[model samples]
Target: MKLIDLNRDGEIGANCHYIQIGSLNLVIDSGLHPKKAGRRAAPDFGPIRGVHLDLIIITHCHLDHIGSLPVLLREHPEAPVVMSTSSRMLVERMLHNSANVMVRQKEEANIPEYPLFTHEEIDRIAKRLTGIPFGQAKRIQGGKDDITIILHPAGHVAGAAGVEIHHKRRQIFLTGDVLFEDQRTLPGAKFPAGRFDTLVMETTRGITARGSEKTRLIEVNRLIDSINDTIQRGGSYLIPVFALGRQQEILSIIHDARKFRRLVDCPIFAAGLGMDLADYFDEISRKTKHVRFNRGIIKELQIKPTPRKLNPGEDPQQNGLYIISSGMMVERTPSYTLASGLVGHARNTIGFVGYCDPDTPGGELLASKPGDQFLFKACNVKTKIKARVERFDLSGHADREELLEFAVQADPRVIVLTHGENEARAWFAGQLAEKLPKTKLIDPVPLQTYQV
Candidate 1:
């Protein structure tokens, strides 16, 4: 079996990895890098040039993991893209949103640009998707060989899964993006019964050390306390959040705090698609009260607000708190607009909830020093640094301890860590090498191919 590196660098996008076992070709996670300053960057597709992939498996709906799929489908035309039902729903939303951005960027720039794919390509890929649930095994025919692939709960996102491939006498496991007992949304990853020959895992948060889940609630409440203190002093609280995971987690936690009056009663505005998604999640929890669904507490927090929705020319003095989406403050994004409006205002605080690329506006906010000033383009508001800027490790990704625990449990003959920067990847690899002396720890090199 041969493993090919697609996008060895994590977070930047264009992560395309391929696995070849005899006649069967398995392509995993064809994705694109986020656009910087309105320009879309391409992922490294060098390893897939000479061969045609028979099957494509996506782990989740993050644009970086599935963004390149439509183009790949447009080019391949015959390969089946497989994912979970929740993932399909998320993919549709994410793809359409991304396409809209590309179109808008093109029109605004007046530059001749190629959209990742047409709506036709999206429709075709949607049709080609085989929505497989967790714990099911699918066999793909490769003209000369048969390959069995299994999807196991990854707990990263609603439909994220850890993929396992069984071919001949060998087994390979690929963890797309994992939530190892963080308990943000889904349950922790389910460990497969048996061992595997090789393991491919993503290390998006390898550099960060996450606190215990028990402390997560404490930290969240602490942040809320600070926000409350600011607001009680006649300040506006602005929390820039990721539209999906982090936003939901924060809502659930704050809702619990408010129920017992631990936190102040303020308007928790769920703006953008994040609000809709949160509502959908609450509905899902009501239907399926499974512990796997962390909706029990959230269900109680779903009480109707007093209709505080805002519009153009609306007064902002009425609400005390605002939670908005697309965490990264990019131009034209709702969170960006809001942050630009709130920044440099002494009475307003903007708290970042998730990862932010350095070039984006959100990243800039994260990089702000304690006393530095920030510019708000939308409102022409110059906010002072009086509104506190703080970050809690309320992340979905596994930390060092979690990574070590996972490596020990999922012990394989060889381990390859991807989706992290150089320092983080190296630290993880070194840890594995020291702890698991018998296992061969591998760090992915850009476009390199290794036989497993």
Candidate 2:
């Protein structure tokens, strides 16, 4: 079996992998980088552009994992796309939102190729999608070989899965952003307890061991305390969250906190694609029993949608709790716009609930001290950091120790790490070497093929 990293950055951004097993050629994911723009954001598809891929599997609907899917489908229209049923619904909305964002960027940023793929193109790609329920093994003909693919629950998002491939006598497992611990909305993964020859895993949180010491319950309580304190001070709170998993998880946390009286009743506002996804989460949870979220919570809590644009002097919603998207607070996003209106006021609080790219606006804001002056290039505005800013390690990824434990249990002869930066990978490499000295750990060089 040969594996190649298609992403230019070996780290988290633009995650994609090409796997060649005997006669079978498959692309794991085709994603867009959050930090890059235009073609640069997409994975390096040039290497496998003309190759005949037998199958394409998307593990989840996160933009980093599925963003450039339409572009890839346009290039390889014959390949069948496979993902969870929830991902199917979520990806469609995500791609449409992506296209709209690109169009807006074209008008505002003057990028000629901003809208890399159109809604029409996305529609065409959607036709090829095949949603498979978890735990079912499907066999497909790969040239002269029969390949069996099984998707196990990943517990990362509403419908995330870890893919298992069986070819002949060999088995390979590709963990696409897995989480072993349960979130408020989703349960933990239940992967088959067995060994594989090759284990390709993500090392997204390898550099941070902090999560290992803190439980999700602890983090959730801390978040509730922060919100309560902010609201009690006659301040509003803003949570910039990822549209898919984090938004739902945080909403559940807030809802439960209010029910227990840990948090005061306040007007809850949400905007962006996450609101649309909440309906899907509700449907899937009811149908599949995959998530703990209820659509009724949205209505019961009276979550209102924030206007697309808030006026400059619109007095910080007066003790409202705003859950907005563009988790990284990307420029022009609803979170960024709302934050711009709220940050200048000392009475408001901007809370970060998940991972933020260090280079993004959200990360920058987290690093800034109170009373610091920061410039938001997207809105071409500068504001004082009078609003309280706090970040909780409410990460969806499994803790480093959990990953180490999983890897040890998998007991693969060859372990290849991806989806983490150099520091993170290096840390994992050191840990794995000490614990499993006999195993070979490989950090993939971008575009380079490795035979296992």
Q: Which numbered prediction scores highest in TM-score against the true structure?
A: 2
Count residue pairs with overlapping backbones in model 1.
Answer: 6
**CA lDDT, candidate 2, residue 443:** 97
TM for every model, in the order presented, reads 0.88, 0.97
lDDT score, residue 9, model 2? 74
Clashes of 2: 0
Q: Candidate 2: lDDT of 276?
A: 83
Between which residue pairs do clashes occur in model 2? none
lDDT value, residue 395 of candidate 1? 64
Report residue 102 deviation for candidate 2 (angstroms): 1.2
Worst 10 residues of 2 by lDDT: 309-318
- Writing each residue's lDDT as its tens digit, candidate 2 over 320-395 gives 8999887888887888878888888888988898888889999999989988998887777788889988888888
lDDT of 1 by residue, 1-452 (tens): 78877764544566678888889888888787765322245555655765788998998877778877887776677788998656765677777766776777677656356476666668667788877867878998887999888888777666777888888888888888887665645677775855778888877776776545536567776787877887787776767776666677777667767777888766566556666676556644454331233444445654333234433222366446777766776655666666654554566777776677666767777788766776654434454444466666566666667767777777789998887777778778888988889998777677777866
Alpha carbon lDDT of each predicted model? 0.70, 0.87
